[model samples]
Target: MTVIVVLAMIFALLALRLFSVLGRRTGHEQQQIPAPADDRPAGARMPAGEQQDGRTPAQRAAESAVAVPAQAGLRALIAADRSFDVAQFLSGARAAYGMILEAFWKGDRETLKSLCDADVYAAFDAAITERESAGLTLDNKLVRIDTANIVDARVDDGVAHVAVHFEADLSAVTRDSSGAVVAGSLDDAVSTIETWTFSRDLRSRDPNWQLTETDEG
Candidate 1:
């Protein structure tokens, strides 16, 4: 019985020592997890679609254009129109895209006349007249333009022509006189890609570039 008691005491001491060496973990203990390294300044929140290299998609595209350099055609265009700026032209093209679409939908011929060349205006007018004769009206909304990039540029006989590629989302519907939907859907937003060419005479006094042609891209 004495031996048994001695053994029990030794075992108890060993158990107590083990517990002391490895303290009990309370539920309130803080977890130790390595934090991810952030190169951005403290309190900086990353912008949407921004990379760790600090370049956005648009920025990357612009950098690529610069690295590749302008083609011979674009160089000629720049030479013909000394005041032309590719960046500014693209910005204006984006605005013109939305404006032209909206004007066509509203059948605003006068507005279209101001923005488009004679051929484009005639085409737009004919479409509007046909729709009117058929007692149909178009309701269109430009949801958003995802991207607009210069796809082609050239100068021909002092005429500077630029083709801009655009990707956009639109909501459109055509209604008949009875108010029934004839085409497209108001609830459905369609994604479309188009290449629109704008031209201007470099020597002409008028500063506006007119829409010369449009094609599905």
Candidate 2:
């Protein structure tokens, strides 16, 4: 009878030890594992006040504007053109700068016509014509464009005008009919800076902007 009691007591102690190590639910512990991360698309996960890109609407709007202090003119311009995006505009301007320069040198009038305003196209055409009349040819290549920045923006009478400052490296040579280099260096790269103004009519259906004016700096 004593051995049986001893064995019972030993079993009770062992059970108590196991329970202590394993722990028991006290009706206060977390009952379920956390739900797996939502596998829905990003846009479906959060709908209100958030953009598809995970930013709040206000945050996205702020990012779309130019990274400068609020100018009355620029703000007004944005108000007038609801679809205007400063980042996208600057990117397109950079590409246009290179394209225009190459087209001008190669006498590609059709390309220039599409990119420039009427007056600007006339000026480019006259220069190309004169070069051809003088029996001179220009060999120019855009080595690289270093920077393109928006220096000013404004809207006038439904016309939006923006000025972009461009700094680029180029290799160019103007040669006469005798093949003698008259200007620029073919072997050396030259750094050039120019500010070009682009304009678009808000009332027009065309989404394209045209180069209206240019200034060398």
Among these predicted structures, which one has the highest TM-score? 1
lDDT of 1 by residue, 154-196 (tens): 7888888878789999998999999999899979999999989
lDDT of 2 by residue, 1-217 (tens): 9999999678645533432222122344321111123534545575486544455555444343333542445557667765565555665677678768878998989878978999999999999999999999998899988877667778888998878778899998999999899999978999999989988888987667889999998
Error of 2 at 142 (Å): 0.9
lDDT against the true structure, each candidate: 0.71, 0.71
TM-score of candidate 2 relative to the true fold: 0.67
Specify the poorest-scoring 10-residue window by lDDT in model 2: 28-37
Candidate 1 lands at a TM-score of 0.68
Given candidate 2, what's the lDDT at residue 33? 15
**Local error of candidate 1 at residue 175 (angstroms):** 0.9
Task: List candidate 1 stretches off by more than 4 Å.
Answer: 1-70
- Residue 30, model 1: lDDT of 22
lDDT of 2 at 30: 27
